[model samples]
Target: MVVVKYLLKFLAVLLLFIEIDCDENDIESRVVDGQLVPIRRFPHVAFLRIVLPYGEENVCGGSIVNQFLLVTAAHCMDFVNLRRDSIWAYVGHENIDEINIIRSVKKKYIHEDYDPFLNTPISDIALLLLKEALPLHKTIQRILINIQFPSSKFVTEGYLAGWGLVDEVNETPTMWLRSITQELLDPRFCYRILNGRIPGTFCGGSKHANRPRPAMGDSGSGLISKHRELLGVMSVKSAKSPSVAFYTNVTSFYSWLVKTAQEALQSTCGHL
Candidate 1:
């Protein structure tokens, strides 16, 4: 059964970003040294933090793609170890505690091919369906997903934001939202390391510093190219400095995203 299949494996990728208390100067984007991103700059970046029934906390990122949809990484769902009822999505606020509006996730659609055990997760994307539609105002809006493959000339410096752990040793998230600009590297090498390259996946990282790799929390964080086009969700990370950050390519799954998200919004709770 799908439920059982997901239940058996716990994701190790999220653990790779476990917070360590290294000097902030040594590791950047620990949420660590990234610049504070004001709420108004990219309000659509949703804080998808979760608190387990047992009291454990998890932080992941996502972006509002429609009135009722947000795209995130499937691993953020904790390989199905986490439940939709326990997960909450926050919008219109830079601080998680000060979120302006919150919604329950009515449903989640993970790519059917997601395999938690793979060295690198393929089809790591997931779409979260909000129980209620968001009110698209100036502070909060939708980021358009990229359906066409961005050409080499079109690729730009990518920017990513999230509320992931700031100190690698502390196990606590950053006090405020943070953003960093990263360079998109060729992903063909990542495909080799990941063992398999799932369609719609790419890679990115920074060359300026070497310490911690890039991670956008658990299930999802959006990566926007220099042109501000939605590239995909930040999925896996390597602990090595100047490491590659694997992302699920938005273009590879654009059609699936549209069909599933639109259908989920149109149907009632029980209808798949």
Candidate 2:
């Protein structure tokens, strides 16, 4: 009788653990001060599923630059061991729970100059080569990368979409994609505000305070211009100022991106 009682206790504990795991999985969509994205509105937006070497999983956002290429922040690949880690990209869905087209990453290229230890992250950009080309459809399309550098005198606004944390306090990601309009601050002001931590080769947060800004997990998403051009890759948020987010200017690395993409496509061997 004691053996049977112990067995029941063990099974009950196992059931409780399973229930907790399921509840955690149900938590979703955490973009701060963002709204639900319309279905197929940002088709180029790709959700990356990254499994680290230690078996922990995380997510980052990317933009489908082409049928075979994805653009994201280089920091997302930091500390990842490709031999033991895995990455997958999901496209064509606003809700993560919905079925979407998925592709494995065959190659990853981080900028040669990217240094994670720097006080300010420059060249914080990376590209992933999909194992198979994504089929272009109404729900799956590529966004053009903007190579034109913005003038330092003017403030420009763009849209930022992601499935990052809703707020610092809540610390949870949303199940659905969310987005907000962010004003790219003037270069001179941005430099002063961020105290030279970020350079002009990057997009800084709005001059107005308390604006909706990208948070954790939003890194690697695209900063898109009004013309549907990808202007930057989400990089970092200011530690002192939570509202001030930084993005890697895509225009600064246009040449490297083109060369790397061409090389990645031509090579038969995978470059992790």
Candidate 3:
């Protein structure tokens, strides 16, 4: 039977940034503040640090798109002042301390139909407007989010990484980067796990005893394929049966994405 679980809680990602320490294989997950953590764990995924006046929060994960815009989940804006200059996005930096490259949010646009309190996180995607365009050569690159049904072949047994929690709700945040592998169950099996709370969402988790699991703070992180293509965004999971996590299917929202991107590129809504 397929199992559905939320990846991590929203608060975890919204809290202070932490760094992890470990040897090559014997890595330890520690939550520390005021240190720079590298983003070498997931080459396919890019790490995004959302900065506010108080401090920087790894509140959301984003995909590189043309170096100027970072695509992320819209729910990342919850409790966040979208218009505040306190918001900043950093890309091409694995270590937060080094200050590899940073960009101010030119603007932010959330979907119109996005209801803050809906099941399945309706239209939960968001985009970060960067002050400067990115250079495609050394430090940055873009990944495509398919706007159609994803291949069960490419998606099954996929890899994902993010800065989330090491435990359940309100737990101490993970000090460093974390990641895991999971199986992409068929839609029918996934629906069974959600108890019919299916939001046209996709499913993936470790099929083996050693597969990686999403913790509390990994919300809005990307579930990526072997080719590094984005498949979904981590949104919800069962706090108890952690093995079952639910993510927004990127392919399912293709139509809306195309429209949104076009609108954002065209008018005064450059950052929306």
Which one is best on lDDT? 2
lDDT (Cα, tens digit) per residue for candidate 2, span 1-272? 99898668646533321221212232001258888896477888988999986578888999987767899999898877677888999888888889468889978999999897876778889999888767777778778764466453543777888888787686867878899887776566657656774552565565555777888888999988777778888888766666777888887787788778767655622331
Residue 269's lDDT within candidate 2 is 28
Candidate 1: stretches off by over 4 Å: 1-30, 79-85, 191-198, 207-213, 216-219, 240-242, 268-272
TM values, all candidates: 0.79, 0.82, 0.72
lDDT of 3 at 247: 75
Give a tens-digit lDDT track for model 3, residues 209-258. 23356755556677777776678877666544446566777777666665
Model 2 residue 2 lDDT score: 100
Error of 1 at 113 (Å): 0.8
For residues 1-272, write the lDDT of model 1, one tens digit per residue: 88665434312211111111123321102354567888787766888866676577677888887666788888777644444237788988887778869987877888888877766667888888777767777777777565476777867557788888766556666757888766777666656656665666777775334534455463377888655568878887754434567778877886677667656655733442
RMSD of 2: 18.4
Model 3 residue 93 CA deviation (Å) reads 3.2
Give me the runs in candidate 2 sitting further than 4 Å from their true place.
1-30, 150-155, 197-200, 207-209, 268-272
Query: Candidate 2 — what's its lDDT?
Result: 0.75
